[model samples]
Target: MLMENLLRSKEYWSLIEHGVVTAPANATAEQRQAANESKLCDLKVKNYLFQSIDRAILDTILTRDTSKDIWDALRRKYQGSTKVKRAQLQALRREFEVLEMGESESVNEYFARTLAIANRMTSHGEIVQQITVVEKILRSMTERFNYVVCSIEESNDVTLMSIDELQSSLLLHEQRMKGKQSHSEEQALKVSNG
Candidate 1:
């Protein structure tokens, strides 16, 4: 969260791209002042970053001079190298492969779980296509959802269909099933009474 906020700030842009100023040996008064101001700005940004993070991290970066150093250190520690990212993505892929809609879970719950993992996969640099998600949803759902899944596959372009549309259809089907159950209960009560 702090990282996201810092990335959004102007100071971060300056630190990462232009970097802090360094006054030359033969620098004029105005030039020295400008360089000092730039260094002050970097310090303020670094302080804000330190405040946002935990004490453990603070200790690790205490020796860092500029905001750029702190930022890069944090990024390296958390975001990891390319190999680390690849390993993370592979783990997420395994989790996705075995992801199944629980028999007792609601339509909303299942979609939420599925999208969370999908979003994580995307964050880790895996390109999870809409069609892949749709196919996963269609195949991994409970046995009761077979009819709706088949109908969706037959009537709509699964590749073009968004996850929201699929969720809506499943939610509607769940509502209809509940309504039918209540109607059947009413009919049974009436038959017994009459």
Candidate 2:
């Protein structure tokens, strides 16, 4: 996709799509000039492909006659079959569905975990919405956050809340929980020492 975008940006994609142009012996001067220009563009595209690949892969494709051949070879070598892709997507979906925040995990840590799976799913062609992620986080948080989750759900329109906003709110609640626990511990220590 990156190579395609680059070629598209430079208007060189047609050379790859249509192969190199060849003017016949009886062709007009303009026809010959156009063919020459197309061959030059094909070489440029080939150069770009050669530079992007590693030494080992380049060696395997060195015998390919044109940029289109090289591109097709690379695509076949790297792109998995439909069945394999489907299986991988299924696994990712299961992982996302079972995701839950760990007892000692911080808000950022949980968010990172969830978003990583979500991103992989997205790359596999799944449409993961922000609201779905937010709702998942809210419902899958540790039991200690139950009150905070309920309060947030009650006070906010979750459908409109961005993931960042939800994360920020949960992080503030987590900090307050930690602060209260530490303060209580300090009070208990003072009483015992007294």
Considering only N, C-alpha and C atoms within 3 Å, which residue pairs clash in candidate 2?
Answer: none
Candidate 2 segments whose C-alpha is farther than 4 A from its true place: 1-74
Q: Locate the minimum summed-lDDT window of 10 residues in model 2.
A: 75-84
lDDT top scorer: 2
Q: Write the per-residue lDDT of candidate 2 for residues 105-170, one digit (tens) a residue.
A: 999999999999999888777899999999999989999999999999999999999999999999
| Predicted candidate 1 versus true structure: per-residue lDDT over 48-80, tens digit per residue | 888888998799999988888888888899889
Q: Candidate 2: how large is its RMSD?
A: 3.8
User: Each model's number of backbone clashes?
Assistant: 0, 0
Model 2 earns a TM-score of: 0.71
TM-score of each: 0.77, 0.71
